[model samples]
Target: MGSQKFAVLLCADDSDYVKKIYGGYFGVFVRMLEEEGETWDMFRVSNGQFPEDEKVGEYDGFVITGSCNDAHGNDLWICKLLNLLKKLNGMKKKVLGICFGHQILGRALGGKIGRASSGWDIGITNINLQPSKIFSSLKMPASLSIIECHRDEVWELPPKAEVMARSNKTGIEMFRYGDHFMGIQGHPEYTKDILFNLIDRLLHRDLIEESFAEEAKSKLEANEPDKEARKKLCIGFLKGRL
Candidate 1:
């Protein structure tokens, strides 16, 4: 429980809304996981920036963030991110991937990722846990409700990857690729306000129907995500507590 260092490979730029409201995604994530004597640094990988190779070993853990870009896309930055993840895996460093990050990790590790047949899945969803295969140190419930906002999902997991959690909307909601790496399709770092803003943006871009957006918002308002439970899950995994 001494000083610990962590890096966030942020895959998306701060939307104007996020910047003004939550101080950006970095702020959002740090608030969720930061503890005493801990350090958090960020790299905007979506903008083609990354930590230098020599600096990668300094952090105890790395977190990959969500993005608007498709995880399966062949963009230059995305390709570079994939390579970095491969290196992290090779080094056996603790790495947590969220949403787009999850798909990218799956794709990088020889898994199949594509747009979900169910299209976009937004709101709080309950995932069934494979308790036996999961780490016993984790005190998470058999069913977990999390904030979801994604169009793509992992179609097939990489070799040796274990499906730890699944939901009706997605076959692979959460997966663990060895002890050092994990990918979650939902946003554990997101609060209801963040999702609300995101819904507005999606509506403004005409990416989602107004009725669907309203319904999603209503559902989100009706229930709360298991945030503390999620925080415990992410922090425990990163810090070797679970």
Candidate 2:
């Protein structure tokens, strides 16, 4: 192949912090996953901008990003995005969903998504990986610490979907629907600074208690997410190297 092409269906708006620090959420994702000769384009699905039907097949794979909006909500844009996801699935196009993306993917594929009974799960968490041929080419430990910030999760998996990873705070932390579609509930694209900034935003918005914010920050100081490994896993899937 000459070069791989990819698109990011961004479902979140970039905060001023992210725009200044990482060039925006789109930039955050590209920094983590972009490879030489690969092309990355973004569609702000959060703003109702999406690839038209004629444009969907131009890329090798698609990535769905986290959003502050509830994935379980039936907003007009959300429904449109779900339809696009259904189309992509029918085509067997490779799709990677993270955070809100993960939850929405579950709903779109005949699963269930709801408020996490554990409430918010922030900071770093270690997820136990399951053995699968899809992961054979990449080196991974039994458990990998990853960045997490979500209040909703996949409550049930779609038919034929297999659980790939889980953490104490959430069940179905990661799942796969056939070889072409995967959903990860953590933020593999987030940097510590991004999480720090996010905590500040949540605090300002009164979405989290100060004590909880402090606790999440403290956890961040203790461990780092296995970002490189996540990068490899995502790239491998998109490029057929998995």
**Candidate closest to the true structure, highest TM-score:** 2
lDDT (Cα, tens digit) per residue for candidate 1, span 58-128:
88999999999999999999999989999999999999999998999899899999999999999999988
Candidate 2 wrong stretches, greater than 4 Å: none
Error of 2 at 91 (Å): 0.6
Q: For model 2, what is the alpha-carbon lDDT of residue 26?
A: 91
Q: Total clashes, candidate 2?
A: 0
TM-score of each: 0.97, 0.98
In model 1, residue pairs whose N, Cα or C atoms come closer than 3 Å (at least 3 residues apart or on different chains), thus clashing, are none
